[model samples]
Target: MGSSARLRQFVHDNGPLILDGGLATELEAQGAKLQGDPLWSARLLHTNPQAIRDAHSRFLLSGADIIATVTYQASIPGFIRHLDVSAERARELLMSGVHLAKETVTRFDSGHQRPLVAGSVGPYGAFLRDGSEYTGAYAAEMSVEELKVWHRPQIDCLAAAGADLIAFETIPSIKEAEAVVELLREFPDTTAWLSFSCKDGKCISDGSLFTEAVQVARRSTQLLAVGVNCCPPDVVEPLLDSAASLQSPDMSWVVYPNSGEDWNPERGWKTSEKLSATIPELSHTWLKQGAALIGGCCRIGPALIAQLRRELKGDCTPAASAEPS
Candidate 1:
């Protein structure tokens, strides 16, 4: 079956798809020094690929139905400029991210369900290596076509590498989301999901209403799901609530929020007081709100993902605090 059909079938058989938790977070826990690196976890695609594979394996063991590849900050230009490799080699590295995740899935024994690999395509602001990804300030300066041009190469490489789907995640603006949705036309066979970095219950990072942002998903028939990621867990319900009436019946809501902690560009993730509700608690609410795909983001590790799987399977017996232990 094609990717779109495969995803629909999975969601039909499964109540809600379980995505893996943070990749970079798990990698750091495994001893990969990613601080201040432009490549972030993508650098490991070349430096320590085994670390990336190990991370994927852990999420799989934790019961993730889908494991996204470590390409969220990877791009041809960024790799060439930072890793100092030729353009061809950079593309190879981008493809390697998908290969690593696929390798892990092929070796795992998940009983009746086969896990999928999503090639992560982060926003253009991520390429800036600044906090623009959260603020989306760069979207104001770049045209939709320019954003599409910047993202085309990475999407091409990921699709060619045989990723099950393209994860256009952490998009902070409507303009970039439009660019990505339109760019999907280039790869007629590829299916993807676009998730925004929300600033609140109602708006994306660029201050555009999420209801408006999700409209872009309607432009592409190939988009499997659309929702928010990397934002605090508290904001997800409101965001989804705000867009609930506007959503298409066929479009699924895919949400994987952070552990309710704030991010500091200079200082990294700032620890917040523990949330009253655990990820599974919040995810249960999200499931009621129509979220078809669920997981965690920053600071959410494999242990938490395992908790999420248990909670989703009706094993809710008061999981430990959602705070990453």
Candidate 2:
């Protein structure tokens, strides 16, 4: 079976799925910067593919069953930031991510365990933090025509890249989400999983809750699944609480939350706690609360993932203990 088929089976049998952590932080740590161009966040794609690959390997070692490709900020205008990463170049980056993610498993999986490679399509913004700003402020109306022109190359690339499934993450508004969802409608052979990001109140910048977001994504072609990302873990419980009872006849509930609270852009974020422990605790709670899939957003990394693997291997401390008390 192809990798995506295998992962599809994995999701079906496990019911609950697990994905990897952020890539930009790891890349930045390895020497990525916002040179002059400010659009394409994956500026290091051609010049620093190894850095991206290294980040994926780290997540795999941390026990991630799936790792997303590094095309999050690879839009055309976004690509023009560093060098001229044309739309075709953007396509190459997406495919390259799949190749590297798959290779990581082959290279490091000592026994027979290997993770799935998922292609990640971030919002219309930069990364997660500045991601929200990408919506509303950009051209009025999101412009489906513009999106079709902008996203076609990337979509074709992902479909041809053998990604397990396209993960559309950190979307702040419904229009932006719908535009991509519309693209998925054209590609019946490929499946997509859309995850949105919200403000403090659990409402999307477009003012929809997880319910509305899920509904929109569901209509966008039986999307493999739908959920939230880049929001706080504290909000995860509440959002799950709000959506848990609402049965989706078609879609699965996936939640990829941030390690801690949202960072304040004004003074910047400073967490008093250690991520080594906090992030796993947060994910543990998410898993117990019926989240069909779980992962981390900004700042969370391999160490947190390792903690989760340790906890999962040991029975996850009993569902009762994992409950947010």
Candidate 3:
């Protein structure tokens, strides 16, 4: 079977496929200072690639079925502007994100199923580094064609680097979702999944209805899955429930929410006193709701991934429990 087909089949035979936790979260736990860097974790691709490799290795060992490359904020223009590198060199850095993940997968002896590498394609607001990704306020100003133009080079490099699939994650608006779905036609063989960054149970970050966003994603046959990401965990079930009837059978619901904490652009993640449901507990409900691809986003670490694996697989082996830094 082809890689895309394998992904579908895995979900069919197994339950929801376990995706890796936050790359930046793990990197910070390992002592990488990323605050104020426009490139975010992508900067480490040029500065400390081994750190990237090591982070991927940890998730694999923690039982992630798929690990996304650290290219969430990587773009040719961003690299040129921030890293002061030429376009060619910037492209190389983008491709290296995939290479590092592939290399990590190659070296790991999991002795089980091989994990897939997903090329991370974060929203344009991520490149802006102004917290617009959460609001999707920028999408209103950009046309679909213009968004495609900005996203083209990164998509081209990721596909060229041989990612198992593209992960168009944390998209905040239906417009950007439409642009990405349309862009998938250019890479006919590349299968991808589009996940939105939602504000509540029913709406995405731009205040667009999540149901409408899923409809936009449905326009692309190349998209193997569609759902929400980087949003609070509490909202995922209702989002899926509201759009349940609209979901296509062939397209799975891919949900990987954050730790149910709120984000403050100026102060970063706000501390919460209210305890929230763990991923494993919530995942059971998501699986029942037909979420086939599941994992974590911000503040989710390898330890939680390991715990999730054990919970879903019913393994009794002890796993790491260190909280994310």
Model 2 agreement with the true structure over 223-289: per-residue lDDT tens digits: 7677787776666667766666664545666777766644654444456454335656666676676
Model 3: per-residue Cα lDDT over 53-127, one tens digit each:
888888887888899999999999999999999999999999999999998887776566667899999999999
Winner on TM-score (1 vs 2)? 1
The TM-score obtained by model 2 is 0.82
Q: Flag clash pairs in model 2.
A: 37-81, 39-78, 40-78
| Model 2 lDDT-worst window of ten | 316-325
TM-score of every model? 0.95, 0.82, 0.95
Which residue runs of candidate 1 sit more than 4 Å off their true CA positions?
315-325
lDDT of 1: 0.88
lDDT of 1 by residue, 71-122 (tens): 9999999889998999999999999999988888887775646789999999
Sequence-dependent TM-score of model 3: 0.95
Name model 3 segments beyond 4 Å from true: 1-3, 273-277, 316-325
